[model samples]
Target: MTPGGRASTAAPAEATATTITFFGGKGGVGKTTMAAASAIGLADAGWRTLVVSTDPAHSLGDAFGTELTDRPRELSENLWAAEPDAEAAVRRRVAQVTEDARSTLPREVMPAVQRHLAHAAATPGMAESALADLLMDAMERVPGEWDLLVVDSAPTGHLLRLINLPELLGPWVEGLVRQRERVASADSLVAGMVGSQERDSADDDPLLARLRERRGKLERAAERLRAEACVRLVLLPRRMVLAETERAADQLSEAGFRLGPVVLNQIPERPDPRVVEAVWRRFEPQGVLELPLAAEEPVGIERLRPLAR
Candidate 1:
């Protein structure tokens, strides 16, 4: 709605490449299912699309019935999909960083820092940063190449972190990368543990420079994407799911994020009077996954084809 930005829809509108939407919410809310269908639909309607799953437990591969990897794999003709490996990505990031540090830092301090990263990677927020790096890479290398970049996100904690994280941590990571370079040069601006001239002169500065530059690029990826990104949430009709949605909306608002459409997945489909009592009976227990209800399955392009129209 800004000069050339995407407009929010009160109802579904024509699809355009400028819009990048995310399907997210509670674990069992059919996010991956909906996301896959939507991407397939967009592709069928003539837009080139990519669907990336940020979840540690990825299922986009299963949803598409095709083998996938960190790299984009073609599904049919126009749809491309990937499931970013959060843990493996973290290890790759560390490998690149430590390899650069091996020649820069004093032999004693470098090993200690490497060990610290090993333990830190086992924690929660560490993996998210690595995923953020992937997000940055995607946006820069292929901007304007795809009509849509849809994400099949993880559960609440990860979904919240995925979009808002880069902006919050970008400066801190940049500062740390800068500090490492300064120490390696023996300037020891903050950590005066070495002689001024004896700093690790053999260290690589470009690697740290690239990391810092990458962080800056990531800091803007979300907002830049937001010019078209809509954080659409899917939810069950149950009280717990709806209540959780409210809390998520509030928290994301605090981080400058807004929720788009709330997809009511697993709702009942056309019913007959003969099965009236039976339908409610089935849904009452299953809550959202009953057979009589509209089972949110991937329909390839038949269902999603209209989303772009």
Candidate 2:
């Protein structure tokens, strides 16, 4: 424990290879505060850290006492921050996919394709999928630029769904690709038997290639999320919060995600050690961290540095 409250040791020097950390929990559990503080901590310790918020109702900027755009902006010497506009990203994806279809598919097939894209934009998991796409893209663009990535995710349910996206959508996209392949093969066979016009090159089949590409992206995202990231749950020291953490832990474990340390945030000045221990034991995290409730709201680098420690 440090001066203000319990603290974790600085991340080992060897752990500086573009790691991703996710901080998530129920709403109002100080998720943004803990994530921002942790990012600042990592940055202060000499890592190039980029912290981004995936929550639609963004508050990361408020936590930092600064406005953030979709592009990351410097928050300090080593820390940068951004709040991705998920809806905007989804809209862009929809337009891009539709445009690709329009350019490649037959004219008569475009109206139906447009309708399908419209429907997909409203699909249950589309937003989460789009968010995941943004995350993966960020990772790809950060090879030598960033050493640490931290995400202050949406509330537990939504964030978990985002993490599970590849598992949920990968097979669906694969099925679509498989079905398209079967249709294309049958069409070729028919054209051959009837001695019709020669079929175009396989590389010219845009829809099939697009489907395969989507599947590949989803699979890669899912594998990276499971294999290369650390997930931490932030919570208050309330029974309801404890119960929620247990449920979230089970869900994450079942989805093949390993839970890292749990941050017990906003502890009272004279917090009861027994109560904290009891609640922490329920989650059985690798470690438990305690953060004192701030006398004033934590905003800006100065106020946040101590909490980060």
Candidate 3:
């Protein structure tokens, strides 16, 4: 698909099939600019679109010359943009998980539980998990408030982790649910032996309920990502960038995501045809969409339009 052109219709249809397109690459690859330009193109085509930045160091706002928050801000007709605060997202997730534990666990153990949770909040993958949850929320808004969602993700590594969260965490949540079920079963058995009738059913157990809810959400997110989302890696013509993009494409494909066209941004005026040919050869069956280096920086919607074209 060329910038704002209709996304590939090859994806599996859902009851509300809102397409999610992601743009990602190494730092300085102009993915943010590409993402903003793409969103503008979609809006011009009459698709109600919301473009979001999941990168910690957000530049989507700069691209549009507007300040943005986690809430969507209208950029133009049919186009909205937002940059989610990664730190706030992580804190909110920690608070929610802590609240859930507080409601389920005994008061005597609450302090230790909180401590453990605090440590987990500081763990390496916590931020990515929170960001993935935020992305899932955006996905759930499809065809209701917007017809399309565009994500300007972080650098390659973080974006990969964010995209892989559903696949990785779904099974972990399922295991928690099973463990809770076993504990509830044992509790029921003990209560029966003692002739006590205060045991709660598995469905009514707070922890089990929470785990099941999380598992269901993750499962839905995974299905949408694997079946309805397309990831397009934006890259420059440099050798290092090309290498990273190649690896990213392979990883995304192996993770069951549909790889869209690789976007080659900022092509020089006297570009080497050989390098372009090499890129096409490397990514056969996946189109290579090129954007020429702008005479001036494409800062706002009007300047970005020609690049989108």
Q: Residues 18-102, candidate 1, lDDT per residue (tens digit)? A: 5666777888777887888778766676666788887778888877666789988887766889987778889998887787777
Q: How does model 1 score by TM-score?
A: 0.73
What lDDT score is found at residue 104 in candidate 3? Answer: 71
RMSD to truth, every model:
7.4, 5.3, 4.0
TM-score per candidate, chains pooled = 0.73, 0.85, 0.88
lDDT string, candidate 3, 143-240, tens digits: 56888899996555665665576667777877887888787788889999999985775656777787777777877877777878888888887777
Q: What is the lDDT of residue 3 in candidate 1?
A: 14
Which runs in model 1 stand beyond 4 Å of their true positions? 1-18, 154-156, 174-204, 269-292, 295-309
Backbone clashes in model 3, listed as residue pairs:
none
Please rank every candidate by lDDT, starting with the best: 3, 2, 1
Q: Give residue 186's lDDT in candidate 2 (0 to 100).
A: 79
Evaluate residue 170 in candidate 3 and report its C-alpha lDDT on the 0 to 100 scale.
73
Q: Is candidate 1 or candidate 2 better by TM-score?
A: 2
* lDDT agreement of model 2 with the native: 0.78
Name the runs in model 3 displaced over 4 angstroms: 1-18, 154-167, 191-197
